[model samples]
Target: MPRSIRRRPGLAAALALLAAAAPAATAQQVVIYRCTDASGALTVQNDEPCPAGSREERAIIEPPPPMPVYVPQAPAPAPVTSRATQAAAATTPAVPERPEAPAPARIADADRLPPPPIFRCHTPGNDRYISEDAEPKPRCVPLQTVGINGDPSLGAGAACEWQYDRCERIPDGEACDGWRQRGREIESTWRYARGDARAPLQDAFARVSTILSDTTCGLPPG
Candidate 1:
């Protein structure tokens, strides 16, 4: 017996549409079967074959390829070349650039202020002290000797000259701290002094207070 070849054109088209809309997880292709009974009535169904003794046809429907997903790639690290190493890296692929981070704000030291000046003083008698006065008054010490020419109290004399002292600019932090300490000491003394002595204490306190409040000593600006 000769097998009748029949095809329902719409069935293949419909199955193809379904295959395209199918989930990507479905890896199997769509198979459509066409069937005809002995009475010559035609039927079409997916994934079903004709009954025994009936003519049949098969059609395959393939799903459309999935679109490729996009992903960002990081820049390649720089390679260093050496005289003893393998072939030196000549060139590398260009990579997408990233935004640069913002730089911190800054102000020059000269623009803001100069550090407070402090002097380290040493006296002839082995006494040491620090001075903040820009124009220090002349310090004079009397010449004294325990013995001269076998005399117990040989000679004593007075002389006047400006003492030499080492001066340096202190860091802003240290200067700020020094000014604060000085302010505290000035306030303590101001509370104890009275009448003529009160005037000098007030002046000293005001000077240190200004230094403390206005300078950052080398600290970054907020």
Candidate 2:
């Protein structure tokens, strides 16, 4: 049985260079020479350039990475001081230290987890919409339309009714699904949306983004 030989640093470095030059397709094999060193001691030598007789091919040993040679950095030069005038900074007799302006109040981002609830709402004519408000008050709607004569003034037919929009808190799962979906949609449309259309999307994106920042929302997975 051929034994694997652990060599010195010099040998290891040489082997590493030789292995690097070898074709990548070469099998992880190296020829090992068993012989006597110049000292005449029985030993397995790795530095031998060639085998004298029957050669043993052993698995190539991986060499450690080269150790970095560190040269100690020179100490910095000492700064020269001028003794021209060592007097205390000229003092203004009545000078008073100005009070530091109170630090500007820190505004916190809405990073609350399990985001605030979103509600689905609709006003009279089955016109549906979503809202964050729980109990929204009804609004007045003019029931009259333009007159046949184009006069537009409704003398006797003028009427109005209070429209109560229906609303319900959607499931958390459903709300979260919609929030993530809307975020993706907003990102998709970001390049195209312009002027008026972009403003509302910006607001909507802000709400969705708040949830996106929370890891518990399961977005952008850990």
- Each candidate structure's count of clashing pairs: 2, 0
* Candidate 2 residue-wise lDDT, 35-143, digit = tens: 4443443344464543444344333454444445678999999775555432333333534222122232233434335756767777767776666676788788787
What does candidate 1's lDDT look like per residue over 27-55, in tens digits?
Answer: 56777777888977777867777888877
RMSD of each: 23.5, 27.8
lDDT of 2: 0.57
**Cα deviation of 47, candidate 1, in Å:** 99
- Alpha carbon deviation, residue 173, candidate 1 (Å): 3.5
Q: Candidate 1 clashing pairs?
A: 172-217, 172-218
- The residue ranges of model 1 lying beyond 4 angstroms of the native Cα positions read 1-130, 145-162, 188-195, 217-222
lDDT of 1: 0.60
Candidate 2 C-alpha error for residue 123, in Å: 3.2
